[model samples]
Target: MTERVCVGAIAGAFGVRGEVRLKSFTSQPNDIAAYAPLYTEDGSRSFTVRLTRPVTGGLGARLSGVETREQAEALKGVTLWADRDKLPALPDDEFYHADLIGLSVHDTGGALLGKVRAIYDHGAGDILEIHGPGRRRVLLLPFTRAFVPTVDLAAGRIVADPPDEQE
Candidate 1:
């Protein structure tokens, strides 16, 4: 398991006073500030985000060590991470995307399909990208309750029920 999970990203400078455009990934968006002193993925830098106000694309915020628009702009695209333990405990069916990235994928008959390539949410819902076995190309499987029925994190695998294959 990764020690840190990305909680938000710095979009750009929000105001002239070191504020930034923050895109939060937390389930309770406003709670991002509770995970203070977020770290960069590379561990080279860190920031404490304080919510300034809500903005158009995302939220507006102030980042520690960012004193100017240029300094804030420099942080654009910088992802903020928090220690796994700092996050709230999830209920039975909920999962963190960081935990699902490398889990093995299998069919109901126990056939090995491949590993999880990535998970994406393009408005509608979450989609699981699976890397095909061997030379097989990548495939997108909707990560819905009907299609993906089981995710046993301890077992390091997910049981997929492809909707189209049901017929």
Candidate 2:
């Protein structure tokens, strides 16, 4: 796997001074700046983020080479990446979404279910999306211990004990 990790996204321009609306993915929002020189998905472009101030959704940031609203807007929707090593080490129970990607998911019975497709955070909390065969579907599993008791990064898999079927 590559060392690139997504840390945030550009949400269009914030002002006429090249400041762009930044939506950081860090738990400590300001840490986005600490991971300087973020890169685009393909590594073709990079940026140094300087948070100018707080905004409703995230932060207003200045990109190193961007100097206009138009330029900033052009970067909207671009996810910024940083070297994985640059990120602070997480605690034992904590895991970075980037690390979960591509991890195989299986039931307690040792049956293969799917692989992690994406992690979603819609304000409330994080949800794991698993993609796989007959069980191949995006299951919005709550990222809590009770829901997902085990995540073995070393084994490259997750043990999901889904809730009892209501139907």
Best by TM-score: 1
lDDT of 1 by residue, 56-134 (tens): 9999998888999999888899999998888998998989999999999988888887889899988898999888567
TM-score of 1: 0.94
**lDDT of all the models against the reference?**
0.88, 0.87
TM-score of each: 0.94, 0.93
Off-target runs (Cα >4 Å) in candidate 1 are 164-167
lDDT per residue as tens, model 2, 1-167: 45988999988888788889899899999999999889999999988877899987889888899998888888889999999889988899998898898898888898887888999989888899877766534567888888888999999989998776432
Against the correct fold, how does model 2 do in TM-score?
A: 0.93
Best by lDDT: 1
After superposition, the stretches of candidate 2 with alpha carbons farther than 4 Å from their true spots are none
